[model samples]
Target: MNRPLCIAHLYPDLLNLYADKGNILTLKRRLEWRGLEAQVTLVTSSEEARPGDYDLVLLGGGSDREQEIVSRTLRRSRDEWKAAVEDGLPLLAVCGGYQLLGEYYQLPDGTKVPGLELLDMVTVAGSPRLIGNVAIESDECGTIVGFENHGGRTTHHHAPLGKVISGHGNNGTDGHEGVRYKNVFGTYIHGPLLPKNPALADFILQTALDYAGIDVKLEPLDDELEKAARTAFQVRRMNLSEVAAQTP
Candidate 1:
């Protein structure tokens, strides 16, 4: 019997603004469908993060106030997380949580919001929040689909998760969508991010399982509904782009 996959969901109460809990649900259901046992634990602001205790770590988006609170909490466990990542633990951080994984997030007023420095990247707040359905062409995970809504423009020296194919990503000027380093992934894409992109979800899960010393191949699940949802979002984005281009 395989060991149950353990996922530590950070700040489920606060950093779940964009229905990010759906990502956790997607991961759990996928594992259950494959006849694998899965466990998800919510790590709150009061709790210390023990990354070594979990196979996968998930951090979702939140409002500015909520992010500040979580940032302080994450700082307390920075060393633990750094060690865990070095040990090959997988992490999926999105939006606000993604920003917190970087060097620092600079506010519009020039205040610096400290990050965990897990990834070699920096995010600066800018005008006109990047909000829309997005598609990206990834080198490792193929095309990824999601929605992004953020004011932070992230710039990284490391390899990007993917190149933008549809909507504004990262800084809007850059064509990149997210940052990828080792087993850690940081992205601005929300839409809960996983349901419409099962491939990406599986990639994270597999990585987690691999780190857990499990070598079982994952059986494929019926992703017909998932694919259709992705296609519909892509079509909608295309239509919106066409309309914007034709206007004026």
Candidate 2:
């Protein structure tokens, strides 16, 4: 595995709300830190690339307007994209990117943003948005922490990444937080999503390595700072729901 892993970062310019591009940096740096090489290519509507053409793909959060633009871009490569995902391409989609993987995300005023339909799910705008720190319990990754802020209420038909340990998940009603299908993952978690959760990041890299036919178990890296961040995170990270539940 001397060759660099090709990473396609989709819509960095438009879908970069809340420093979403940080996830891309997190992935690339993690690979390098492990003595592995990774090459990232920015893919936008103008630079649409086949999802299967890369070792990994990352779609970050964005606004509704940006989602519409990306939808059209993806529509051009729809079949190819669908084939790639079905073929087990390791993809991580966050926030608006997560919604893009579903059937459709219906807006408050009745405008439905078209999605890639890769996942059997739908997001409809709710009255108040789901926001604040998120804690999910995953059997594979243990307790994962991040921030989520969205108005969409998603109904998932796919297996959930984990149960909600804190904060609002896919929908406040459901105890789940993200979607897991084949090698593809969709989540509303963002705090740039990977820096605090190294296990999940490495899980994606390992899956990508496996998908790319690279025979290697990922070497573990020290996550002391990441752990410390989580420890400190409990101090100020607030969730309205948690506050309400604890009220006497």
State TM-scores per candidate: 0.97, 0.94
For model 1, the stretches where C-alpha displacement exceeds 4 angstroms are none
lDDT of 2 by residue, 121-152 (tens): 99999979898888999888888898999999
- The TM-score of candidate 2 is 0.94
- Estimate, for each residue in 1-248, the C-alpha lDDT of model 1 and write its tens digit: 78889999988989998888899999999999988888999988778878879989899999888888888888887998888887778999999999998899999999888999888889999999988888999888899998899999999998888999988989999799898888998888887899999999988888989888887778778999999998898788888989999999
Error of 2 at 61 (Å): 1.0
The backbone clash count of each candidate, in order, is 0, 0
In model 1, state the lDDT of residue 38: 86
Relative to the true structure, candidate 1 reaches a TM of 0.97
**Model 2 stretches with alpha carbons more than 4 Å out:** 235-248
